[model samples]
Target chain A: AKAKDFTYSNRGMTLEEDLNETNKFYLQSEIAVIHKKPTPVQIVNVDYPKRSAAVIKEAYFKQASTTDYNGVYKGKYIDFEAKETRFKTSFPLNNFHKHQIEHIKQVLNQNGIAFVILRFSSIEEVYFLEGKHLLSLWYRMEEGGRKSITISEVQEYGHRILLGFRPRIDYIKIVDKLYNLS
Target chain B: AKAKDFTYSNRGMTLEEDLNETNKFYLQSEIAVIHKKPTPVQIVNVDYPKRSAAVIKEAYFKQASTTDYNGVYKGKYIDFEAKETRFKTSFPLNNFHKHQIEHIKQVLNQNGIAFVILRFSSIEEVYFLEGKHLLSLWYRMEEGGRKSITISEVQEYGHRILLGFRPRIDYIKIVDKLYNLS
Candidate 1:
């Protein structure tokens, strides 16, 4: 799957870039409106030079209390988190935090669309798993079950997102299918 | 109004701190799940001094493309932008960006609750005005009308929020009235 037919430079681009491109495509095509929340950073010190832009002298990543991406799509609120892992066997549960899980649950209780986007960075594969499925697995994990979700399980329950030229993550098609959108 | 019985605080806490405290109160008091979106900064240079923290050496403020706060409350999706003004007569239209207006319009079209929280810092008064009203005013401003929303108009359609110890904004009470939640 990795070496079959790939010619694009996955070069200096981070996962954020891919997701952003995907969102841009979705917006232009009028498919969905989604965006990655700005990375939460705590700035402690800054230096403002006379003729230069302000430079951050010190900063730290602040723990996000909610998921990364959220927006409205076709009369429904959409929210989700995106994670990339190098491991092949499973995606680590530690990638998610307790508060984020609680937030997603609350969103679900309010009849909003909540999910997680898992990226297998090694193989360049992405899967979108609904929040309910992830929650059930997470609960089982808490009860001394699997600590991580296996790739096979993800494949069974999640939709495989094909990387495209525009809107890199075109997951709205899957969303439309799951939500029965016309 | 300046010489009223109201007290003043010059603690000079950052905007984020004020919002965090307000959100903490909101959460504990079951008011509304309102939060400031993390500040958007474009990192041009970064230094990995140690494994613990990555220091950003150079950064610039990126124009925000969406409204700051959004969440579900009482079965309705709530989206809003918080603005603080010192002017007594009117709140400037420049406080809201074009994209933010478009985003609010999208939320309204989806049947979600969209509004603005305007804070007159000098008077310590806050008002919650529906996005539709803001958009109407904004359109008029574009057509050579007043470049700001007058305090009188705001007083008419907006709910005055009396900041308290718990749930500082206390806008959820207004939400309950708007949505007939209870």
Candidate 2:
């Protein structure tokens, strides 16, 4: 018998797809357990076709109440939201919601790891910004400060996640470094 | 202006209504943060009516990837699933999916609080069964044991929750007791 070959390409994969694939690889390798939340949808009607997959007749996207990805990684509860922006100056505060900030605060209060993944899509740069930094900036914004976080600020405080093969995000490696797990 | 007088009803409300009311109370009380997860749906079609809510024309309910309720509670991570079953003998293991079980195990591995709310609708009884107990029984079922957990067994290991006016589930109370939190 020949050895089975399993390889994947990241070409043309959206951020969500790439993350999903990466998580799957991590799970199979027993490295981490992470999952992208399903898109929230409001459904009003449906059609059940005989001998065919059920078809959704009507629905609309709804804003999510929590972060995008959250799960257990190396004995720590990891929670995060990922966003892609084109602006180089900074990431807009409006990209996050008041409820999400509150939720992240609660997670942090409970001694869990909570953060945001900011992707400068224009330059293909991704940074993992802790919730504390985001919350501080968010409160400052509410108190009449700038409405976004500058790229230079993120570069200083957030861990830069270098994209790679196998586990594309390789966030756990960064998490290990940040949490001193290693 | 006269203060509005409100009358309380003893007649029970639907699970959905109770849950919503409970969530509001939790938010107001600064207790554990938890919310019923919105049902996942796959949409195939939709119609945007003129100056009105977008009507969903067709959609189908999708299986959830993680547990329904998860948040930070009393300096600990809280994660659980809510289910109502009419069966008197036990809760059907089939109520949960494989992915959900995997997710719960991951949460437990991270030292987080994980459990399920089993409501016997006919008897109006609710029990908070810990994830470890549930997982053990689930594995037993997979090994050709009873397909469901008996109410008596649940009563032995699970905390019986009394539905109340505030914090309907009062799950945090059990969590507090279990973890010995102040």
Candidate 3:
């Protein structure tokens, strides 16, 4: 029923797609309530025709001030940003904006579960990097260190989510494990 | 600095504007971290020019599947939708959609803070209707009750939020009082 109205492209499950499906599964099963934030667009011009819906004629994409996704699970606030890179060895830090980093820190200060999901699309590997480690890595970059996190560093700092059939990404399993939610 | 980039219109602070400013105040004061979700737009066409940003050529607004404002406040997930009605005596229920009601219920089931901020524009009065009361009211409407909620009914089920100078709405003050937040 909901599928009829969902008009987004289905390009064989990118990280966002898999996470969206996983969130949907969680929703249907009453396990959690999560959603991806819509892309922020700056509307410059709008046209209103008689008896017709308003159409945005000119708009530009704006950088998101917060992470891509946020919600609640088992009374815990959940927040994360998802990104995929084709690089084989590392995930580039440039994929994240400064405001997003600051937003993650704010969530952490509020004792919320904050993290990032990085995908190495070349090898089909997805890893969840903890927000603490991300902050530290971002600080290192600010101090003129490496601008990317190696695959091994991600493995050490984060957990790998296994792809599933029903939920697609099964990220809450990792969330449960990460937060010791039992 | 952020004001320069915040390109949205300012028309003497509508309910949404007041809420946005209030959320910004909470964020800056380190009292809470709430934000209004961006308006969802369905993109139909995009134009990318050489050495320039991609411009959205065609887009249409889509109904939101969740509440407008949400964030983490003192480790708890906060969610709500704010609406203003000019009807003076009653606020029409049609301002809320089915998905929004369901979204509030979902947030409640997860033990998150969920509610609606109703503004009686003509009377210059605002009320914070609790989600539980909202659900009960919605059920009554489904059972063929009044389509609008009277001011007295709202007062009985919710708290009156005093408009503040700094935060504009100061809704969290009511939240703290309602939840006995320490």
TM-score of each: 0.85, 0.84, 0.93
lDDT of 2 by residue, A1-182 (tens): 11112212226556676688888897777676676767677665567889987777767778787787876665567788888788987899898888889888877876778899888876677788998999999999999999999999899888887777666667778778888977
| Backbone clashes in model 1, listed as residue pairs | A22-A167, A22-A168
Proportion of the native interface contacts kept in model 2: 0.40
Higher-scoring candidate on TM-score, 2 or 3: 3
Q: Which runs of model 2 end up more than 4 angstroms from their true locations? A: A1-10, A46-55, B1-9, B46-57
lDDT of 1: 0.78
Could you tell which candidate, 2 or 3, scores higher by DockQ? 3
Q: Any residue pairs clashing in model 3, and if so which?
A: none
Cα error, candidate 2, residue A2 (Å): 29
Best candidate, DockQ: 3
Tens-place lDDT per residue, model 1, A86-173, is 9987899989999999888877776778899898887778889999999999999999999899999999989888776555666787
Error of 1 at B136 (Å): 1.3
- DockQ sort, best first: 3, 1, 2
- Give the candidate number with the greatest lDDT: 3
Docking class of 1: acceptable
User: What is the per-residue lDDT of model 3 for residues A1-182, given as tens digits with 9 covering 90 to 100?
Assistant: 33222222334567787888889999999999999999999999999989999999999999889998999998788999999899998889999999999999999998888999888887777788889999999999999999999899988888876565667677788878877995
Q: How close is candidate 2 to the true structure, as a TM-score?
A: 0.84
